[model samples]
Target: MAPVFAHGQLRLYLLSLLNEGPRHGYEIMRDLEQRFNGLYTPSAGTVYPRLAKLEEEGLVSRSDDGRKATYTITAAGRDEVARRQLDLGDLQSDLDRSASQLAEEVRSRVKGEAADLRAELKAAAREARRVARPAGEPMSGRAGSEFERQINELRSSARKLVRSRRTSEAVRAEALRIVREAQQRIDDLS
Candidate 1:
């Protein structure tokens, strides 16, 4: 997928951020991530080098404050940002659209999954009711008990994963593996 910021766009955007006020490298990174709604975060390697280049060009000045380097945009940086104010506005609009689109996609998928699960549960309940049963006897037995338990567990795990704001790649891969395994198990039963 294409990156959110185009070439040279990041440089200009960083200049615009620094134009806000002095900020340390990590602070700048977090600010950028926040602006993208956690969908995009530039790594330290990507950001520090750009800051260094800006410093070299005298577009920004850096001061060491006890193990932390804070960068302040120079007059030239402010001028550049001012010159491209419209471009900065456009960048903000693009980022807002990207974030909104991502959020909407996630919501739609979650709703679809919930609907599917509800349908499956209803079908299972109907099938259980159709099976022969003694009067006044509640649904209980080894028959389909294991399957129900597994489905419940899977549902709980999925809910937990979805509720989390962030998850590592390993966790996400594990979730996918679990889902695939559950589907395979269901297919095997059929």
Candidate 2:
């Protein structure tokens, strides 16, 4: 499950990733895709501004490597990450519950088909990216179409998963698959 947030969860996730070492923007995003399986990955469009904000706040330090714009954590950022790590579990649980609740709603109302909590969680991530799509960028072509299609398929899968799910193992299996798929997408994009 992802961390619960109406927004800016990606910022926290990025800060947490950067706490490990200096990395370029692409690396930070790819790490998230790896961690979440493919169900979640932050985009450069989303991550870069958050990095800038952390820099402004003295949490992250910035160094331009020609064009790479490498980012590293400052003491304050590390402290922030430490504090947040304590609550990371809670955040993920809350997100899982939210997706479960969404699935329940779908099951009760729409042909008794539940949403897969796992897939719904991925849908949430895709929604975040959709919101982050830049102005004047057409949602067309290979990349955009692939993203949109994945979002739709995940939603469909989630609904089915939630409706028929009866075992913890099944849930875990589906979730693991979603995570792997999302991570693969990030790798391909990178």
Candidate 3:
């Protein structure tokens, strides 16, 4: 995956953020997410380490209050920000580009998933019709009820997984592959 920030850009951006005012770690993360228009959100693992590095370099100072540590920019940090005023614009432009790319990737992935889902559903519907009982037969029985229940459960699970934030691209891709394979197997059974 392409990174949102170039090599040392995240450190510089963190300094710039601190220059704005003292902020807790979570606040900084939220700021970054908002800056990227919800396309990118840095995890705590990413943010805390950078904060530690900045603190180590004397660019920022941290004060612990209860369970939370707030970071404030030092004078040196402000000087660094002043010196990199030109680079700041470049960073913002890079962030904008990254967000656009991320959005496009997301759109493409969703489109592919929709196409796969539609294809699978159509195939299943066609198969179901082919195997369906005669028109005179009432569609109410243990088998019909069980089939309906299973289909509804499958729909609910798919919706929940797709909507979850924890679902990675690999997971989604694997899921689609599994569905396709299942469809193939069902077709074979016919």
User: Evaluated with lDDT, which candidate comes out highest?
Assistant: 3
Model 1 stretches astray by more than 4 angstroms: 112-141, 144-190
Cα deviation of 115, candidate 1, in Å: 4.3
Task: Give a tens-digit lDDT track for model 1, residues 102-156.
Answer: 6666556655655555555455444444443555666577644754665576577
Score every model by TM-score: 0.62, 0.46, 0.75
How does candidate 2 score on lDDT?
Answer: 0.67
lDDT of each: 0.74, 0.67, 0.81
Error of 3 at 100 (Å): 0.9
| Candidate ordering by lDDT (highest first) | 3, 1, 2
RMSD in Å for model 3: 7.1
- Clash statistics: count for each candidate: 0, 10, 0
Output the number of the TM-score-best candidate.
Answer: 3
lDDT per residue, candidate 2, 1-190, as tens digits?
3332457566676777787789998888787666544445566777788889999999988898997888999999888888888566666666567556655543354332223454466665665455445656677676677777766776676656545644334465656566677667545543
Native-to-model Cα distance after best TM-score fit, residue 67 in candidate 3, in Å? 0.6
